[model samples]
Target chain A: MNISLQTRLLLLMSVALAIGVLVTQQAGRYESRRTAAADIDARLGRVAHTLLLSWQVSNDLTVASIPALTVAPPAPDGKRLPVFEVTTFDNRVLLRSHDFPLRTHALRAAGPGYGNAEIENTRWRVFTVIDSQRRIICRVALNEHDRSLREATLAPHFDQPLLLGVPLILVLGWMSLVYGLRPLRRLSRELARRDATDLAPIRSVDNDAIVEIRALRRTLDGLFERLRHAVNAQRLFTAAAGHELRTPLAGLRTQIEVAQRAPDAQQQTHALERIARAGEHMEKLVSRLLHLARLDSGETEIARHTLDFAALVARISGDYARVACDGVDRPAELQGDASLLEALVTNLLDNACRHAPTDTPVEVTLAHHDHWLTLHVRDHGPGLPEADRARAFDVFYRGENTFGEGSGLGLALVRAIARAHGGHAGIDPPSRDGLCVTVRLPAAHRS
Target chain B: MRILLIEDDPILGDGLQVGLQQAGYSVDWLADGALAADALANDEFDAVILDLALPSRSGRQLLADWRDAGQTVPILVLTAYDALDDRIDGLDGGADDYLVKPVALEELAARLRALVRRSQGQADNCLRWDGIEFNRASGILSIDGQVLDLSAHERQIITALLERPGQTLTREQLASRLYGWDGGPESNSLEVHIHNLRRKLGRQRIKTVRGLGYRMAQPDR
Candidate 1:
């Protein structure tokens, strides 16, 4: 069941050639039989003519009655011979060969041309003719077994070619296939030799490869390139996440030390406040890091369903008092993964609320345009500078003047989830001092 | 002693500044590397505590630049990158000492004291004189067999003098060590602390030259 390509191809070709040889063998047998039949008819008619001529020279019925004059004798045995019977119009027998049937009317059903009848336990091809000038009827026949001997002669022509050519062609085909697949074998060997951490692009063993093999090499190289990039990205993310945690951890340690050495309740209370804030920030960072890591693993399936976008955003908005949902009352439906879409909305809203002014509310709007649904979230805080906006979607990329305690993963997760749903996320720099993020998804509502 | 604290994290920087100040140091904290480099060049500090990752500039780059400029202050690298390569590169790039993050306050203080002491040509954290013993780590001064209580200024004066046993320090240099750039007692108030140290450690312990500064008295021949 797990046959290699070479063996499979060889087996298929061998079967096809065998069938072809069998069909050709049948055709050869049929043609040999036909040709033998035709030859037998001609020979029988010639023998009958010769007998008539020999009889005409004598003009004596007794002389023509000689069995040797009638036909050649059976060779070495009675297995084969040309047998005949000369009869008058009144059904009187004039001459009968030794091999002629004893029973009367045994071959009478035979027509004048050529026909077959059994005589003396041997099937015969019979040719009968009436010599009008001689006032006699001549009947000639030879055993049908002779045609089989002729059939044997054709074996050398048909059987030899098939017997020899099949194996030869098969061998040639096998050799060509092996030669063609050599490049693939080399490619697999090269791949098998590599260590897991080696993401270097593979060099095909030879440049004499076919088009398909070359294409396969290019695809494998491209895949390795992508794997290398993903590995590097993972390394950088781990490093950033670890570095980001150090300060908070350091803050916790120093705060505890300060509290332990506090001289008064006031000093202790202040240290405790900083410790509480730092602990909360660390918790936020760790949870966001988990989300980013899961997304990076590329295993999360986007479970698609027809869900109302307006209700989902409204639900996420209601969780935070500072976020307001706009144009989400009636219903706007789209086909998307429910959980992933919810996360995308939540991240956008969280990002907006984090950066928004303390007094102002974050705004969310959903709009549908031709097969596309766009969601926009705006904040009235000091907008991201022109420089920091481009790399906002990069993991762990934060502006120097970023707002308080944003894990820098919120916008990155937003972009990731949106892209997972066959969409894109972008930024629109507002004229006023604010930032707005927009996400677009394909619209597939119910008919 | 005065210290320059260069770190970018808000809470960590705040905590370190407070902790070092509590350890009897005047700490000048800067959150940016470019600003820190400028401050280091234009000012003086007994030692420096630097974070490797900083905005606008990196601590390693600043260290290399400072070393290239022949700035001779002791620098202690405090970073979260615990890789051996990062440590090697930081040290080879002219850092006087290196430490990983989440360090204990006591350890940081001890290392800072050691760096500062070694940079000043003192062998260790302890300074010995004629019948007087000064311990930097414990911040305690003892004469013969008795512990002598001293004010913060008196301690600063004795520490500066003990580090440079025979060398003299100008009034401004001593004031900078005690109070960094912004605050200290009035200009002439340094003499008061010097006089008090001389009294506490015995008059033979400190000598003052006219129109110059103060130095620890050499041991009697």
Candidate 2:
């Protein structure tokens, strides 16, 4: 919960190291016990072999007369001593040590093997060796409790390496983690040092960064580039708007002054007429600007409905009977926001009329193919250059050859409206002489 | 005085044309920058009023081009761009004077007059000859401290001749000044106006240079 990357990594490393240490310690304990038990068994087998050889050398002697064979010596500090015994194949004791725990029967009835036995309520590890030529079996045993106590005494000696190595492992793990995250820290510092307006991409190198960090840096750089473009566009839009609005306002002021200064009723009438025309231009400009602002803010709600595209174009073209006409008569229906569609058509028509020569008629064509309805508005005017086509839809971008008083938002608004209806707008290359702006939208199924 | 007005906006251009015409200056208006540039190259005018944002060519580019081409007609820039940088750019780009839009008609007229006077190497707005002082600002002529009422056509002829005193102005030049290139006066209208001017002021006050033109005669001391 709310843990930093470093802390989480360190915690995971510590837990893993602790488990490794525990497993190593447990394996060391088990191996040490096994090695000690194996050593005791080998020693007991050697003693049994030696006892059989001794008995063969002193054949025909009485058991009481045989020297007391000290098969295993006593402990130096008076601990319990190891026990040994020699027996015949028939299970009769032939020789035995003085401190042997069992005298009524041999340590084991079987011969030539090593195993565990219980004697006088204590457990012992016993080994037996047999001499077939002498018909004798010799056995030696050690207490299980004593062997376990010896193993316990030697545990810390084996654990000394583990005790010193665990902290070193943790330190190394933490260092690697810090070193790996250094790039991330640098990225954060760079972000923190930046001002709000600084949208420059972060510097990056190919070889120095790991893959993950490099990916992160690349994504952030992309974001910065997008933001910078958006900001520049916004700045351009505002400047263009200020320039556009002020010119008309200036016209209004100058026209009013002209009207006031008119020497005669005729001149006054002409000035007043110009004033009215300027007011209309300004009104159109303001409304278009407000529409663009709404689109930019993403605040306008679009209500979509199924409508006949061909019929809509035909009806709207009638409003500009002299300049516009629908080229097709078929029912090409589509689903879209109707008001926005009307605005789109109106802006296109207005743009064509404004740019084209007064006598040239604007052609509106509609076609349906593969669930798409395409609306094309073509004008017989000097079309935009290839270089200007790309930026024609950019807000307030008027081409160099363009001649008119325009708000420069007509094409941009058309594209915006088209996009809102899940469609797109583009300018086709001039085939002969003129511009053909095309809008493509999804066609509704016939019902 | 004849002035060339270059503005792109229809309403503003129309109003400036009417207002300047009423101010007693024969004005030729072009709404396209390229056309205005061509007109400036071909025609001679006392001054030019230019708008910056124009069709086909920007006014700034046209001004720079005209200056490069050694056209010395004084140009006054009238634009809606009032920012400091825009003003600096306009002035540095060979504009004679810069005025932001929403400009008063009187101010624009005064500035145009001043630009014209400065270009003609005159320090004041008064042109005097033969005891008649022409007030360029008021478009009025006063003799012996008494203002004389005159028709618009008579004012145009006197203003044109007074700008260059003692110089002969041909009938065609005076007729163009009075009624522009499109509408020249019909059936010796210039003679009729001259007849009326000779009737009002003393007949010898104007000299008829036969087969050449007319000039203002010197007054006796």
User: Residue B189 in candidate 1 has what lDDT?
Assistant: 83
Listed models, DockQ each: 0.44, 0.53
Evaluate fnat for each of the predicted models and list the values in order: 0.47, 0.61
lDDT of 2 by residue, A1-447 (tens): 799799999999899889989999999898778877776777677777677777778867777786556455667864455677777779777788876774435357444688777767777788877777777777777787877766766677778899999988888889999987888888788889999999988864642458888788888889999999999988877878888887777777777877888878887887888788889988988888887888777898778788887787887888885555554588877888887788888888878777788788888888889989888889888888898889989888776655568778899999988888888999997799889999998888766
lDDT (Cα, tens digit) per residue for candidate 1, span A17-112: 889889998887777777767766777888788777766776575744575654456667333557777777777777778757665475756877
Model 2 stretches astray by more than 4 angstroms: A53-81, A89-95, A102-106, A109-112, A119-121, A204-209, A260-272, A290-301, A308-311, A324-332, A363-378, A382-404, A422-443, B18-26, B78-93, B97-218
* DockQ category of candidate 1: acceptable
lDDT of 1 at B71: 90
Report the C-alpha lDDT of model 1 over B1-221, residue by residue, as the tens digit. 78899987777887887777677777888887778889887887889999987766789889999999999999999998888999999999999999999988889998989899889888878888776788988889998879999886778778877877788888888888877766675877887888787777777667877678877786565
Cα RMSDs, all models: 5.8, 4.7
For model 1 the local lDDT of residue A142 reads: 72
Which TM-score values does chain B get in all models? Answer: 0.89, 0.92
Compared with the true structure, the alpha-carbon lDDT of candidate 1 equals 0.81
- List, residue by residue over B129-168, the lDDT tens digit for candidate 2: 8689989998778887788899988998988888888899
